[model samples]
Target: MTTEVKPSPRERLLEAAATLTYRDGVGIGVEALCKAAGVSKRSMYQLFESKDELLAASLKERSAAFVASLLPPADDGRSARERILHVFEQVQSQAGAPEFRGCRYLAVQIELKDQTHPASRVAHQIKANLTAFFRSEAEQGGASDPDLLARQLILVFDGASARAGIQADDLTGLIAPTVAALLDAADMR
Candidate 1:
């Protein structure tokens, strides 16, 4: 017989924060988070310095899976243009999910509204890393202006994510062509 070990209190709390904050907003209070995690407020504090720290840690913990969900594997042998489009294709698929709520990092930044907040900083770094990925891919694709192309890609990504998140746009015929145009304009192969 195999015994399934339950997650520790700390892991449960992190899971709860990530799920609740994404579904609801960062406005979710500690009480609700503890209830979801089945942990006590005292235990929550003992595991984390504060709610902000918990939020930050949760974001940090999920960063790897988040990036993997978007980014193509490193050196997959696809052209730069193909790699870039892979990201948007992933976004469009994710948006089709019923639980999609735009980008979590973007949501956190919008809700916190304080760049210096611990969670805000973590969110910022995650986005910056995404932009950096675009830049690197742009350079590899031989874009006319890698920086410009990267910025344009991130803008489209965030815009598409936000719009689809709110159900304002299905992105059915949108993201792919828009990204292709940008890549074409940048003269990327």
Candidate 2:
């Protein structure tokens, strides 16, 4: 016999928060969040100190999911450069999903705007972590200027995500070859 333990209240709330944020963006009141999570306001307050804390926790969860999905493969039989470029294909596939709504971190920044906001801080940190991944990959691929290449790659990624989310366009076909050309220009491959 096996016992199935249900998700904790915090897990349920974070899951609900992530889904609602993807569907409706962030900054909804605690009452609304409680309703969405199917937890009571008392439960939410017991789990998180405030709405900002809940939102920040939810953003962190989403960021981890993004990193796990978008990180280049280590031994997937593709060159590091191709693996790096594979991020676009991964993101494009994710964007095409029914519940996609661009990046949730970007959504928080757009909605909050204040640099001091907790959610804004979380968003900035998530972006910095992504940039770091690009930098590391660029270095491993033998780029002469790994830092610069990483910055450029982040720009391309940002643009592709924006276009994919806003214009509903498919960029997978162009991304890999374009990235390969950049690697070639950098004497990487």
Candidate 3:
């Protein structure tokens, strides 16, 4: 008779890693992650072989979720600017969520010294894709120098993330006006 195994150890590890990485940043150790996931150290090692591999998988999982969350649901019927602004709104909303921490990618970047790590590489790719998305939207909106506009908006985005992470305060007020100014400037040029 074969007994059905419950949730796989790998799944548990990934879930735990995602939660712990988001809540405490990537500085969290493998042991803690295994414990949180309710997996034995041997199980974790069996699945990932090393912390770096586990981290890479965890980062990938988080990146996928983050991008999915950024997508506007059907029926929102919002303009590009509104959608962009909505991203900030979501960030602000996170401030009130239980166990709120800073951007997971940024946290990993800070904790990991090696720029070439798989986790770091994936994080950088995600940022670049976001910037490209903003630039494309700006260009389609007929903004002169869409690249520049995208860069400026990225600054605001990064600033908001950093401020919220560091100060534990919502920077939504600052972001709204600045975004408006950006759109206005884009319109003029």
Task: Using lDDT, give the best candidate's number.
Answer: 1
Candidates' RMSD to native: 0.8, 2.0, 3.7
Runs in model 2 deviating more than 4 A are 73-78
On lDDT, who's better, 2 or 3? Answer: 2
Off by over 4 Å in 3: 1-6, 73-77
Q: Give candidate 1 misplaced runs (Cα > 4 Å).
A: none
Question: Candidate 3: lDDT over CA atoms?
Answer: 0.77
Backbone clashes under 3 angstroms, per model: 0, 0, 0
lDDT of 3 by residue, 110-137 (tens): 7887789988887778888878877877
Indicate which candidate wins on TM-score.
1
Clashes of 2: 0
Which is the winner by lDDT between candidate 1 and candidate 2? 1
| Tens-digit lDDT string for candidate 1 (129-183) | 9999999999998999999999999999999999998899999999999999999
lDDT of 2 by residue, 1-189 (tens): 999999888998998887777677775677778887789998898899988888889888887678888986567777667777678778878877766667777777888878688888998898888888778878888989999888887777776776766756666586677777777877774
Candidate 3 lDDT trough over 10 residues, lowest sum: 68-77
Candidate 2 — what's its lDDT? 0.79
If ranked by TM-score, best first, what sequence of candidates would result? 1, 2, 3
